[model samples]
Target: MQSTYQTAALNDDYYYSDILYSPYQTLPPVIQDTLLDRQRIIVIANNPSITQAKLEALLQPTDMLVLFNDFIHAEFFAYHPSAKDLPKLLFFRQNGDSLLHFGLPPRSNNLTAILEMTKHATLGMLFGNTDYQFPLPSDDPRPNDDPITANRVLEIPKPLDKLLRSQEHCGVLSEQHSVVADYPVFADIHSSAPTSGFLLYRLLLAACLEVQQQKNADTPISIVMLGFNNENKTANFWEGHNWAFERQELATPPHGVEIIRQY
Candidate 1:
């Protein structure tokens, strides 16, 4: 049977600096095994900071994909920053009789379509927002630039909500007001100043841990970090001597939620 996902080029208008992947040698043996054995791939754009070039580069190698875009979906909630100028990641996948379209908000029926797409995959990745807050414009007139408190509980789109709910194992890391009850609530970084790169790292780490527990020993889970810079701490963390397959304590915001792992 044909796979449900495929890779395509990024839109011409999008700009980016570079594309980086975790060297296969750097990853844990099991994770490396999973990537090579199951061919499961996860792609994430934690924030708008990522460039289109990098996003496309990650997709070139995988058939199973996940994209996260807080900007396009901002309309559902009241407080996300405007991403009008940003170039969106676009790609297509064959789903049964129709093509599964991505890079934009899906129509209500599209949610069911997305859920169907997930059924055939062994590993999954989440993209877009991870509960981190961005700074508001200096001249912006909102009474409170900090939207986390003002827009704490966002009712996610029905399709996306359903998709998240249906997942057997999931991980969430957001501010106090940002709630995702379906999955294991990992770190709660309530601060308004954290960078998207750091948030992506935490989310993927948590997601991988959750996946490890649920999947068999041979299953592999690979995370794609989009719009990444070499200087970001996550890049350093992966390359650092301290990195290990064993779960390590994650540095979280004040009053951060904690997760216990089987690893």
Candidate 2:
């Protein structure tokens, strides 16, 4: 019953080239260009099997957090960045979209749906360009609390909550009626697997919530992460982080997206 699908079904669209630098962690000029103008991104990992630690090594801390979910393109994007590469730390999304997506290498039309979600997506990319196995610290320090196994919503930081609360486009019940009108999505991260795609969606919303809550009142530029999980079913404050299998009851809208803000 837990079948994976393409980023398209989730209404995600964007062109991404993993390993732009080839063995280097630096992003491609196009990515840099897009990021310079906008910071918030809704990356679609599509595959969680890939190691995000290796990929983190390449990104600057200013890059922000990565929300982990789904299983679409596992091999292409994860495992590129390493802890050292993070020039800045960005947050990830925590909401769930109530939509059913099918398989990988989705049809062109599905790709179009992924594109629709990208309207406000600034930059999205996978963790690593190659399938490198690397050890990474879990988001939760407690071993008993494996994020993937525990299907529950976490309390987003105050900063992130503030941002999401401030925005009107955080959650979208329909694919066509999303935050697209709010802004133009810059990039979409891609990898070789499907789970990574789910993670990317989570990261996007989480980052947005963080930025909105923490940025200085005078800060001119900010980034927003947006994502929707279809399987999330929790009454604990609309935070998007949840487990697919644990969810049995249907959500109110039957769909939800969490937006995280990062400064």
Instruction: Give the candidate number with the greatest lDDT.
Output: 1
TM-score, candidate number 2: 0.24
Q: Highest TM-score: which candidate?
A: 1
RMSD of 1: 17.9
Alpha carbon deviation, residue 164, candidate 2 (Å): 2.7
* Total clashing pairs for each candidate: 5, 126
Q: Cα RMSD to native, each candidate?
A: 17.9, 19.2
Task: Give the per-residue lDDT of model 1 (tens digit) for 157-195.
Answer: 564454444332232223221111122222442222223
> Each candidate: what lDDT?
0.30, 0.28
Identify the runs in model 2 with alpha carbons over 4 angstroms from their true place: 1-34, 38-46, 57-160, 168-173, 177-263
Residue 113 displacement (Å), model 1? 14
Error of 2 at 93 (Å): 9.5
